[model samples]
Target: MLKPPYYPIIYVRGYAGTQEAVEDTVATPYMGFNLGSTKYRQTSAGKIEPYVFESPLIRLMKDHLYQDAFHDGQILPQGPVSPRSIWIFRYYDVVSKGLGNGERKEIEFHAEKLRQFILHVRSATGQDSNKDFRVYLVAHSMGGLVCRCYLQNKDIPDLEGKPPGDWKKKGVDKLFTYATPHGGIEFRKGFGWLEGLRDFLAINNADNFGKTRMREILSLEKNLPLHSLNNRFPAKRVFCLVGTNSQDYGISRKVVGPKSDGLVQIENAYVKESARAYTFRSHSGAYGIVNSESGYRNLERFLFGDIQVNVSLETLKIKMPGKEKNLSATYDIENNVSIRGLPIPVNKRTKDTFSSSFRSSDTLEEERTHLFTSFLLKTARLNKRRQSLGFSIHFRILPLYHQDKRFLPDRHYEGQAVFDDRLIIEVSKGGDSRFKVRYGWGSNNFKATKNLEFKVDKNNLSTAVIQLNQHRPVNMTAAIRFEVSAWN
Candidate 1:
């Protein structure tokens, strides 16, 4: 039987909302909206109760307790075992006052407090004496950032230093983080406009905690290289679950384009270079990914899966108009065929002058930029497993014809391009699974413009086969065929 895990899980909540308000305030901008909203709430004398999202924490505790009751007999023979414990770390001052001028100081203090809490837990449970005790952290929203501060801070000798000689030999592991922006949020653009406005307010600006300061601390390009929390901890043992949902809040839904999990964009949630990132949800669970069953399952898989998950950019393509001589040229994805042999325009009096001028002018740059922007706008399949089925539909624009006169006027023609891709996963009962991807791109050019289609099916585990087809206009006489194959 497999030995039970040696350590318990620690849950951390995100910004503004506490473990209690997770459910209701998730879709809202908790921290960005509530900053400086309260006065006389932070008297230094006794205690300052801060506003927080409590749903995530409550859900986490309840889920674990439920699991313990339901699966009590599942525990294996091990060195140490008991019901898991959870401690909610509250910072009313930081939440109510915002990051303000002393944001870094406040965060540092909290990090130390968390460190002490961890040490205390280790001591109270007598697990520290065993030298085999492991602690796993799961944080959401800004909580993940706070956790990073704690783990990566250079001042914290115990955390920053290498594990004890005995513990190192025994192998201590850490797994934590969910929907945390390893790459800081795009506060300068998009819906982040409000956050920018808040940064200008004095009552909100307590100190360096303003938007600029937050940006400085969270800047992935800057701080990541200097004091990367993911690197500070063992990456192989770290686990992260990101969130993505296309739907946004009522107001944001109309403003933002494409997809987002309300507040955090999907791209921001998953740090490509991080240890392991998965998705079972959107960002608004108020940093409660650790508390959900799906979250726990993903966590368990990351910690114990026979193979780790790998996600990467698979393919990219762009289509553009061919030079004059190759007016018959077309774009195809399957057969790896590209337009070629377009005779260069030679004379100033011929129709070739238009094509030559178009290629020589800034039009080419504009076309290239348009193509690049279109590719970026396209979204790829998410969370596709080795043997899983997936599909995506997107739109593109194709240039059909253009007319230009030296001094008079220039005419332009374009057509709409639409396509859908389908993926199939084939796996033998006892063998490895292979993915078959097929895509079809169709476009209607001009009256004489043909309807073009391309298809490719590849054994993602092995080789690729491609094919192309075009339906000529009823009035057209020309016909073409293309086919190709390549190996990785």
Candidate 2:
């Protein structure tokens, strides 16, 4: 039987510029969803290690008993298909020279077609009941924008001459994107000249990435930003997997610049208020974000996990030695979160990789810094003895002093961490149906050694806090706050 939150998933492939590229994309059965990696970075230093990651498509079938929506050499065949199936949007097929016309369509056209495809999948899966039909949209690059265009643009006219606004009724449970340029793609080399040239040519509708075109497609006002979902879609239901490795993205990185996944800047890769993760992966290639182990791990957890955990550093007070007022210091917090059995972290931001940045004193005055949010599958308990899910969080704080806008070399130490620690957390349900959280400092032991007090509100939300202490010259008092609740 199909399960809730394990409903069918629709994979949307990214941009295909030329007719040949569209044909190549259409020829693939799973559209790169079945691609896997044989190696991964073992450390933040870009150390390559041999590790086999069976692609997300195969893993879903083996781990969750999910099937693809293909039968008898045809997709969505005549018979009833499994509700727990995977479907490819195949939006570009219509524009592929081999499949349909050689002409191309705008992103709006692809999105409208996507809506039709979803409805067809719903019918083919025999999920007529509104409550039983739900699908997860997983896209890469431009495909993410297509999904957003469909979900967020309420005024988009359908083929039936009706405007689409009942997205919730269409049963889109959640959306996940890998290395999508949510804020539109921008090149760093040119002072807006290169972007203007690309947009003017409109090659393969490249103008879709331009801010003016983005506003039109997303139905946003001139005052609104390109990344804004316009409050049409729930920000919590979206997850953006950002890639941080720019060196591996080929010669394009020379123009795209650093601090990017190669093509999309890190700052432009995600929507505000949405959950996001950073990994040492590139935009496309062998080191691409879509085919990596970290990508699949985060994807499965966000799609099927029942428990949601939001971790943040709250109530911060930093004290520098022999200085109290007008302290010219920059602080950076590096964090990594990994599941119990995984060899790699699902979310990582380290100082060595240049993914973590220094926080200004003005921001610290607000006293809250979000670390990262992760989801845990309740049924996939790592600690069977305790019937709980387990994960560990590592934190490193680095501070650099400055005087008169000039670096003080004497006060800075290379590769120095002012404060560092790891917290191991195990969460399970108590007898009263409330959540029970157990945690311990990893420096103390490998397992949780203390119970974390949690207060369950009437809405079934539970929250806890852990204080981080022990620093030398810098007396910093910061508490890690966790808010846990049920997720689809």
Candidate 3:
């Protein structure tokens, strides 16, 4: 009887390499949405092993009971379809002259058409066309920009100054973009003739991609502004899945840099202050973020799960006994996580480097005010025995950051880490309808944990506790509240 968050999904694929590539994409039935991944996962034993992750389409069917709209290798069926159906915005067909009439339109045209397509989906799903109906938007690369253009401004130029329908009001419940350049990408990473040419193509003001359509659409040329994050949907509803594996990204990696996911820079992939998660995934490939298990796990949780876990340090108990100058400390917060029996890190962070670091001076709200991560937890994934999740948080303190640390007691202090009790999160059941989640954490410095339970009727969303001092007897008194939206 689980429902509400269950709605139709509209997927928008990334940019094509060539006009021929566009043609090839149009020829495909699912527009690459059916692509799967075969990769390795690092277990608690610290071993890399094999794991096969079917495409997002298959996972959705296996987990949430969703299905596609096609039948007999042809178009949609004649009768009304279920609300739990998936659809791809076949946008490239309009751009490919071979697929459509020899007419190619700008992104504005596509945005307007997308609004109309939602109406079509409502009618097809047996819902009232004019009434409100929710749908999740999952886009990749430039498709994310196209989604923004539609959601932000009036895509179609109004002849009589009439505003278009409010898409957010029309029911865009959640948005998830994979490797999208929300802040516009830069090709200023490398050198050489070919590298210069790549930058030239993307930065050129003429019909070339650098300075032409892509640049114009993304506001890459200087001070042009984009209203996508400010208008329509709220920032919290958008999830940016950032990719950080640049070496495997092929040609684009030449100009993008070692810190990018091939084409889009990690810094440019997310909206400011919005929810984002990072992984060692490329922009688009067999190991791409959109096709991998980590990516799928994040997408599923954000779209269909309930609960959010925001953690931070409200107070620091660490103090230097001696009056020592030229000293600094950095804490690398890492969480070892597994979600719903999925063979991937739920936050998509790595075992070694996937974490947020803080400086000794960064104690105010402007510097340290944010959640560690947020995830969707489903009741179906629970076993009869535990009915909860298992995880561990470790703090790796480092001493560096251009500070004058010439003298030190022990050099080993630069690489110190603290590991504590493994945590288990539990949810309430039975007649406790107001109850959503219940769990316990921490003890008297070196003691065991105490029970901490939360209720949904009170908007129980997120919780956290951290140990600040590296010395003996830790104080785990950090007040943390996370902003979480319940999906199912």
Candidate 4:
């Protein structure tokens, strides 16, 4: 059998509140239940539900721009290439009746519908069952989750039952998702108010309504025993398109934190182990990510990128002590400040007078200085005059006073600094100590500069003497700080 030039693109819509809501607002008349002025309702659970609205894909192709393409007896526009077939599969939400049940049933219904749709396409195209044809799944929001459910569930018998062979190699090319919560959302943090309102309405049990159950089902730990990668199809075939612009609507306004595409947090949109993930100029709002131009372009790339790309974090290096440190290390780029791999306990105490600014005049500075000094003094006293504790400091220096034009208005000075312990020292009876210091310095315009300094002392475990002006120019504006830890 000759392979078709293009694969059919299937679009799936997100959660439509109810059958009535879908028919009335979400989808257009022809694509919705208003076709021929006759409302068609889906029947489930011994009740009649409004016809689930079709996705934008079908609306765009059939009822919108390319409507004539699929019209009966219509001739193709004369061109080098002829048009290929496109199909759409629409599924109803179990809660579309507003009765609130069947989250799992919804997934199963969509999966079965997709299978039937694929069979119908194959029969219509007259393709051999043994030959694999490209299948592109374009799902938005919970629709993506529903597709994942289909892919992860292997017990469903393949309707065609093609001979056991490399179907993937034949052409089962790709799966794409838009603004789908692959990682599951932190609904409480992002949509807390909506959740509260849903609870108030006593409609909290709705399936695919929030991130809670989706999270529970999609988690590696939870799904491992039931449908793990080892037991199910590899997830590397799936591609994710995430949204980063959150200004789409009121729903997008509720999500918390630094980055989001409005409805779904950027973090939740990308699946770590998926084949590929891309971010687009869309929000998590109902019509934003699904209908935007950027969304379509990214969807094309994800479906067609030569090689799939998976994102992950790499460990750079372990920062160690023994260098000429800076005084104002706050601006230093070398300052190894990561909450993930650090051992120091952060001071969480809130002092009424203390603020985050490190300026010498800030009320919090005095309290911080006092706290550090008192902590050191108590440690010295407890050691019985022995070198029981030690610290290494780092900082930066800038010519703030000499170069008025170069100084930053918002920043305290024009330099950066950082410090770490280079040597390990044990408490001695005489309270003497030896430690190495590493320092980094950088001007507002220049890249950072670094150097190492050594300090040796007797009976003074609290402070270290750094050799300055030895390795490079010491344009005084540099400040230094240190931390002391026992040898591990």
Candidate 5:
């Protein structure tokens, strides 16, 4: 019997520039999927900690019993494979000088090959056409673009003008991308000249990251943006793991500059509407996002989680004191979230890292600012008997006040914040498999209390609203909303 959601996982690696690199990539068995890290940050102050993440590949096998599609020194065994199997899309092998005809193929060609690869996996896994077969596409960097191209394009003859649709019946059930430049990569230091030159010359086929080439590869119209998903796949099912550490990406970080993951800027590393989480890791290296603990946690949760939770500042009615109401001051919101018993935060966005910030005027006008989306798996609970998941969100709101285009030194404090607190949330199963949510402000309470009320809707979504009038600096009427739903 086959299990849904635990379907086969296909890993597509990033770009290999030269023919030698391609040959080297073909020589690898897992295509960097087996890489893990031993060093991690213990705190926000850059304290080093030693933690062993035995790579996503080994962890999946150890935790979820997921096996790789290889046996006895041979790739792809003859018999039927486990449903929870991992496959690598070796798209670069064809272009490798040692492996194939030594012809560099376009990303579109790789995507077309991916289509055939999926079919082969389906057949080799002994899945009949009548059976509902699905797979999860896990990609890094340019690999994500290839997956997107496969999902968004349909002009290929094999597709017959119909791209991947009906995700459950056939095709990718979900996509998890790590440090992918969905909107295309741009240089931060060069004054627009570097980007133009790269696009003009198409250096090393780097034009694949340019808008013109992206539009063709992703099958987007001239009017549509390159990052637009166009509703081809459900945006909610896509998870973008963005990296924010630019310092450790080697000499390339000098050109990419700040507010980036050493190469891809934070703003361009994700799709517009996809669920995103930011980690302070570099693009690729010892501190790379792919080999980090945060990245693996996100991938595991998104793949097998049974519950979905979204947190947002649902309403913000700020009554700025005195003259401050008329003045436009920028406000920065920081969210640091971590699951229970976890040493590192799965999602972190702080002003210091240039990942989370907004103007007070804009936040007031919008009235809603989504903080983050997280997944909770029942089987992942520390105590299986408890059947619950616990997490904490450190939410901080800082205000930068000014008047007449001049900074006000008298009103501003160095480390003071408009609001600073940690919100603790716990979700457990009550009667009839219905979820019971308990929440509390960590600074005020020792534990989560069930006294909070949740409003249930027809869509089976339960919402809990927490007012933010307890420890705020200003007279603000704001509420943080938590929306919870059952997920696969």
Candidate 6:
């Protein structure tokens, strides 16, 4: 059995509306987390076959050798089993007549209970020992908020005397949230019939159902990057899988419009400085983001994947009119990444592309800002063992140039420039996963490729920065020199 990074996984389910809703939720076996879909319309372009997803829980059990602990009627494991276990945090069980003790609890209360649950998980799985403990917290919707409250808000005690924010020291190692509204949700109200109804209802109030839907998530922004969670554990370990298909999210989508995942806005589904990826799946339904392949693939990649390649544009040199032509330039930087063997890319960046712009009139102070276009993936696959990352960047320039006084638009002024390269890295199965990175660029255009070798071990990181000119190769070229360490 594979060990180390393969710790027990605890899943926290989202919120339920009323006591009846809570009862309905607890009545299910997997608590909606184990839901699967056999029939569905084609999710891809030029495809007719329906996709079949056998739930995230099943996939985790099948792919990673994880098993549920409950054997008889006991909530905890009765006998010795695999170290790797998956448990549904039945927080709503308290509300159900058969299970949950009494009345429903508040967010803070739920967070405290979750902390206790995690402690229980730690004790049950032999993770109480400092050397062999770490849990991956996977949550959907409001569950993510519960996790955030535990990770960020509460000051729970650890193995040692619980210092302030001691929970940040260890226990929960990483987090992956699905379609969670990290930022507060906002119903579109500028120009619509629903806007009138929303205004009539005054739904944004903190006391209403709006607060229940988004109270914890709405307040997550207060815990910025400098806070205990992000600073202590680092924001890089957290990932937000954003759902973009608001069409299937039901009535909430109609009110929130197409830019949301029905219940939550897509733009608000990410934590600051955390790694995020977007999919066309909805928040939940037949087309739910949690059970979909894209969602599962991304989750598996971020959780199980070893290599993390953070792609960024280090510097840019633009060849523009030297302020004499009365012009201003803005270029949008586009990023796309694809794994060699996968049928579709991990993120929907290529299809529904997202671009960040840079203006020519911007000062040097603006250039000091660090911009990153990033994604994560599991390096190794069964059929295709050796992992390869296909990365590409496109530059779209919008030049507003004036001939006389008014800025004149030119139809022929538009141009497309791109940088494409494929990195092939072979990962070792035994001991530490050894990797070597080699980068190259061509003298000509988009076809430029490189092959410079550098070694990187498990914990050690290797970086390479290459300069691409206005088109491809003309002005700047740097010959980088680096010391090589032993690959073994």
Q: List pairs with backbone clashes in candidate 5.
A: none
Q: What is the C-alpha lDDT of each candidate?
A: 0.37, 0.83, 0.61, 0.40, 0.82, 0.59
Arranged by lDDT, best first: 2, 5, 3, 6, 4, 1
Which residue window of length 10 is worst by lDDT in model 5?
Answer: 154-163
lDDT of 1 by residue, 4-108 (tens): 342555555665423233333333332221211111233346666553323433443443341121123321112233425443344333343332232323555
Comparing 1 with 6 on lDDT, the higher-scoring candidate is: 6
* Candidate 3 lDDT over residue span 1-488, tens digit each: 21468788999887776767778898897887889987777777999887788899888988888978776665444336778988888887877777686355666677667776666777778766434577888999878877776666444422122464554455567889999877665675344455446656642121223334554554343444332355455777788888878877778787777667887776678876567777778888877888877788788778876655544444433333245565444554444444546655555333343333444535532355343455646554556466444332332233232235457444325332432433444443336433344334434342224444443435554333433333533222334342333444
TM-scores for every candidate against the unseen true structure: 0.48, 0.92, 0.79, 0.49, 0.92, 0.75
lDDT of 2 at 170: 48
Q: Give the per-residue lDDT digits (tens) of candidate 2, residues 293-312.
A: 88988998999898999998
Q: What root-mean-square deviation over C-alphas does model 5 reach?
A: 2.9
Candidate 5: C-alpha lDDT = 0.82
Can you give the lDDT of residue 146 in candidate 1? 66
Question: Which segments of candidate 1 are over 4 A away from where they belong?
Answer: 1-6, 17-105, 159-172, 188-197, 200-230, 234-239, 246-259, 275-282, 285-297, 311-488
Cα RMSD for predicted model 4: 21.7
lDDT of 6: 0.59
Off by over 4 Å in 3: 1-3, 40-49, 72-79, 101-104, 156-167, 188-228, 313-323, 348-366, 369-371, 384-397, 401-413, 418-424, 427-449, 453-485
lDDT assessment of candidate 2: 0.83
Model 3 earns a TM-score of 0.79
| TM-score, structure 6 vs. true | 0.75
- Per-residue CA lDDT of model 6 for 1-488, tens digit only, reads 32657777888887675667778888886777798776645544866786678998989889887898666767655445456888778888777777866476665677777777767776676656655467788999878877776666535344343643544455777899988766655677763555445535643222222433343432334434222244434677888887777678677776677667787776678777787776777888788888787778777777776556555444455455444454444444433345545555556532232223344436412453223223434434545544444433332323333333455653324333433343232322234544444443323343424544445545565544444443452122222222222211
Best by lDDT: 2
